[model samples]
Target chain A: MNELEKRLLDGFQRGFPLTERPFAEIARQLNAEEDQVIGALEGLSESGIISRVGAAFAPGGIGASTLAALAAPPERLEEIAELVNGFEEVNHNYEREHRLNLWFVITAPDRDGVDRVIAEISRRSGLEVLDLPMLESYRLNLGFDLQWS
Target chain B: MNGIPAIDHMDRQIVLATQEGLPLTARPYHAVAKRVGLEPQEVIVRMRRLLDQGVIRRIGVIPNHYALGYLGNGMAVWDVADESVLEMGRMIGDLDYVSHCYLRPRFPPEWPYNLFAMVHGHDRGQVLERVDKINAVMDEDARAHDVLFSTRILKKTGLRLPT
Candidate 1:
């Protein structure tokens, strides 16, 4: 990656300007052209180095969100994971090294919507679902420093 | 969310229209306004309000940890007692290596962890060392803990509000 790309990925994790011409604003700060800034961001997104460049809502703020887990049998893990992924409500699902290996995040318009998805998943997979909703947060949005050589 | 100010229907539309991402164009908000059938200036104004209200955390480039060479993703869950959990969580969250930390409910005997700290590293050893540092801070206060390394990402998507 070039200096422009590296600086963009490292520096612009948060506090991106909100304006009609946000790319232009970024260019002003980084000493680059507005077009260069746009091009760099487009390239980063296409290369999978950056996911999105938009709003990140607080969990349970707009609607509701919860972290849930279920211990799927080794042989059924893939099948269960696929099943969980089928739900639009399941935004993130991961297989981790634990008995309760299949973990996922569920978001809904309301708390009941979140619970419905969990109940449906448990019923479909025939496994106990652990609903571990966040109680308190101890961290704020501290940006990341990406020093990839 | 008790203290969070409520947004109206139009604001919700703006969020739905741009939640995936802002356009890569120079006039990104203008494009969002077009999608949501609002004026360009209105989109910018509402988004600003959302940011101030904490309804929207931030608008920015989200780095893909995997692509950036962060191969090991460890979910370090620690069982800290209720009394000290707040201070303990703050200590762990203060770690430079900890990307984010939260206090969640424990399911007891089966799942005896209330504090979750995400530590990303180039490899398992590096991730483990970071987790060890957090453990050191908790000292004897930590009753039990375990680091669950993510083996696979089944799915990942931007947060989609139920429309």
Candidate 2:
């Protein structure tokens, strides 16, 4: 990574200016041209380094969300996973190595919606659903320092 | 300003406008304000207030760890004692490798893990090393634990509010 890209990744994790010209503000801070800053950010996003430049809503604030899991038979794991992922409410689904392996996050517009999705997944997969909703968030920040090694 | 406070219509509009992502342009907020039919300054003020009120956790770049070569992401679940879970959670959350640490409910007889800590690394070995370190820190308080490595991303997207 070039110096400009490094700086952009390192610096813009937080405190992105809320202004008419945010790229310009970033440019001023980085001592680079406005277009160059925009270009670098575009490249980063294109390269999939950054998912998006936006607001991360507090969990369970605007919508109801819960971490749910299911133990799918190894032979049918892929089928069940695809079934669970079929729901639009299921945003993140993963296959883990455990008895209760098929874990996913169900995000819906409301508490009732979350319940509905869970019930649907359980019915479709014919497996017990373990709805482990977060009681308290000790830390939720995911940003980390980009080590240039 | 510290808890999940109620949001007004305008606040809802702002969230709906920027939930997917902020526009990648020189004037991103201006684009958002235009979409939400609010002035640029007003949008900024509302966003600041939202941040303070804990509605919006942050306004910044959200990176994809997998794409960044931190391929081995483990969701380490621990079966810690109820009394020590909170304290241990705080300590685990303080670790640089641990990105997300939360107190979640546990289903007994089948699922005994209550605490969830997400650790990431470039490979499975690195992730396991971090998990070992976390286990060392927890000591005997963590009765049992398991690492759940995500094999596939069935679906991944930001939470969407009812518009």
Note the Cα lDDT for every prediction shown. Answer: 0.87, 0.84
Which pairs of residues collide in candidate 2? none
Q: Itemize residue pairs with steric clashes in candidate 1.
A: none
Model 1 residue B154 CA deviation in Å: 0.6
Deviation from truth (RMSD, Å), model 1: 1.2
Please provide TM-scores, in order, for all candidate models, with all chains considered together.
0.97, 0.94
- Model 1 Cα shift for residue A15 (angstroms): 1.6
What is the fnat score of candidate 2? 0.75
lDDT of 1 by residue, A1-149 (tens): 88899888777888889776888888999999999999998998999988988878877667778999999999999899999999998889999999999999999887999999999999999999999988887877556666565
Per-model DockQ against the true two-chain complex: 0.79, 0.68
DockQ for candidate 2 = 0.68
RMSD to the hidden true structure, all candidates: 1.2, 1.8
lDDT of 2 by residue, A1-149 (tens): 57887898788888888777888998899899999988887888889888888888888777778999888989998899889877877877877777877888887767899999888888887889989888888886746766666
